[model samples]
Target chain A: MKNSLLSIYNIAKKDLLIELRNKDVILSISGFGTIIIFIFSFAFDVGSSLSSSTAAGILWSSISFASITGINRSFMLESENDTLEALIMAPISRDIIYLGKVVGNFIFITISEMVILPIFAILFNFSILSLEFITCCLLANIGFSVVGTLFASLSIKVRAREVLLPMLFLPCIIPILFSSIEATSMIFQGKGWNDLSIWFQLTVAFNLIFLIFSLFISNVIYED
Target chain B: MSNIIKNKLLTCSAIFMFINLYLIFIWVPTEANQGAIQRILYIHVPVSQISMLAIILVAVSSVLFLWKRNQFWDKIAISAAEIGLLYGTIMLLSGILWAKPVWGVWWTGEAKLTTALILYLIYVSYIMFRNYFPTGSQGQRIAAIIAIIGALDTPLIYFAANLWSEAHPPIVLGPASENDSSFSSNDMRIVWLFSTITFMIFFVYLLRIRYKLQDTISKYLTNT
Candidate 1:
């Protein structure tokens, strides 16, 4: 267990270091996320009767779309350098690699969300900086990162991965998207934790199920 | 041997389909509220149920494929997903037809309807994954992973939609209560059961043919 944890940490650290050096994924994702928010504001006429729920929906939709780009980049980076092949040949288990990528993708997506949220708040004229809103974001991100990384790895070998990743990832993340939007909307409405607890629990449940499930099946994708 | 079995199953399904058509149109009484349009339920409900069952079958076969590393289970998983997608498409279309006259709309954000659409999309992506990565262990592995994750995430999808629909009460047109005895009548119950069984048998029949077709294609590919 200890060794596996170390391996996972090491792999995640390597990915983070590479990302820090390049900064391509984070920049592109955050840029795309900002563009989506801007477009949504214009398209939806955000200044009018934009409810908090609508704002929440727009915010999540941007994050979800941007995260798809980020997921593709992360896996593309690994596969580009044949880093995935080398890692597969290494002593580390496939689940360890999966956990590592999940951690890495989670951090990347979180960073992009940080950039997107402020822009979303400014454009949509809503304050989403509350603790409850952030908590919901974090929970939803965990579910997204876990499931996204698994699918990203799976789609890495496909020819039209850019198109395929979102197709595969979007439906699976509907629960997270719904829960996050609902919880955030409720938080904005001054609903207490008691009212929003169900959404939070649902997000956490999705995260747990995907996390454990990805761990168990991650090896199948890499194994010949 | 397989050809003989396939022919027998095809004959059985055709016979059952004819019986189902007769039972739906003539034997079953028209619903009081929905009138003749409600007869779509006989086909829609059974196909929808079978589609869900096919997804479960895909998940089980995926597990088996991953564990055994056998192409047979992989074929079964893909074949089941394809057949599931067909049934899901039928369910969605038949649902829209039923809803048009009944609900006065082709679509609604209702929980069950939305979940079924998402499930259909997920199945489509699963087939797309198979097509995109045609010949590798990578493709098979990724498809298996999708099947497993998609199955695990389905209930969460349903629950999230349920929660969402609760916040904004849907404009429901059909039954007012959950336990409305539309099917509680002896005749309705019998027809419902028979249709469900017939659909299940039909699902198996399609699955067998699809599996055989996939097997033949793979064999031909390898030989050439």
Candidate 2:
């Protein structure tokens, strides 16, 4: 188990380094994300008084789209180098590879979200310093990234990888979107975290279940 | 000779489906409030039920394919997914038609309908995902893994619809739900049950023909 964790850590670190050097994964996503936020701002003329209530939807939409770009690039890059096959051929377990990629993708998406959230808050004039808002976003972020990573690995080998990822991903991320919006909205409404415990529970359950199932399925797919 | 027999069976099932539709439209008693529009339930509910069953079959058979690594199980799963898509499409069409008159809108954020749509899209993407890989070259294993992970999204979509505040109520039993008691009177029950049986028989019959068709296509395509 220790060896597995160490292997995954090394793999994830290597992935991070590669991503840092290229930076296309992050820049393109954040660029596209910025455009989406501008569209939202122009489309909805709530003025400078845009309610914090609307922030949740905007935040999630931006993150979801940015994550897709990130996921697409992550696998596309790996495949470019034939790195995926090499990792599979190595002595490492398939689940460890899955874990490494999922964690790596999760971190990349988190950074994108970290950038987008504050910008969204500033442009829309919504408060973002609340602990509740941050926590809700984090849980939903993990859930989306977990499921997205699994699908990214699944999608990369497909003929229409870019088009297929969002088609396969959007529906699956609906739950995360729901919980995130609800929890964040509650916070915006001045309700405490305790009020949104059910959403949090749902988020956690979704994360755990997808983690286990994706691990198993990734293993089977890798073996092939 | 076997192919001819299978084609005949398919033709017979189509005839049965046509007769069932006639009974639903012309013979079945209409509701007091919803009137003739309620007649749509006879077809819509059953198709939706069978679609869910078809997807479950795909999921389970995919798991079997992964476990046994057998082409036969993969074929079964592919067949089931194809049939599932058929039913899913029918369900979506009938659902939209029914929703237009009842809800005063074509589509709403109803829990059941939204999730059903999401489920349909997920499986459709699965089929599309299958096209990415080369056939008979570990494609089955990759497809199976995808089908399984993709199928996992269905239940979460369903539960999310229930747990989150949504316009549509949870479907507890049958396709309409116990909440739809007003719609599920004894008169409705009889026709609905008949429609369910008709759809299931039609589904099985269609699945068998599809599997045979797939066998032929695969044989010809692979030049085996």
| Top-TM-score candidate index | 1
DockQ of each: 0.80, 0.65
Clashes of each: 0, 0
Candidate 2 clashing pairs, residues 3+ apart or interchain: none
What lDDT tens digits, residue by residue, belong to model 2 across residues A32-135?
78778888988887475666557778877877887888888888888888888999998888889989988888788777777787778778877778888777
Query: Please, what are the lDDT tens digits per residue for candidate 1 over residues B45-99?
Result: 8889989888889999998998898999999999989999999989999988877
Task: List, residue by residue over B48-74, the lDDT tens digit for candidate 2.
Answer: 899899888988988887777776777
Off by over 4 Å in 2: A46-48, A51-53, B1-8, B166-179, B182-187
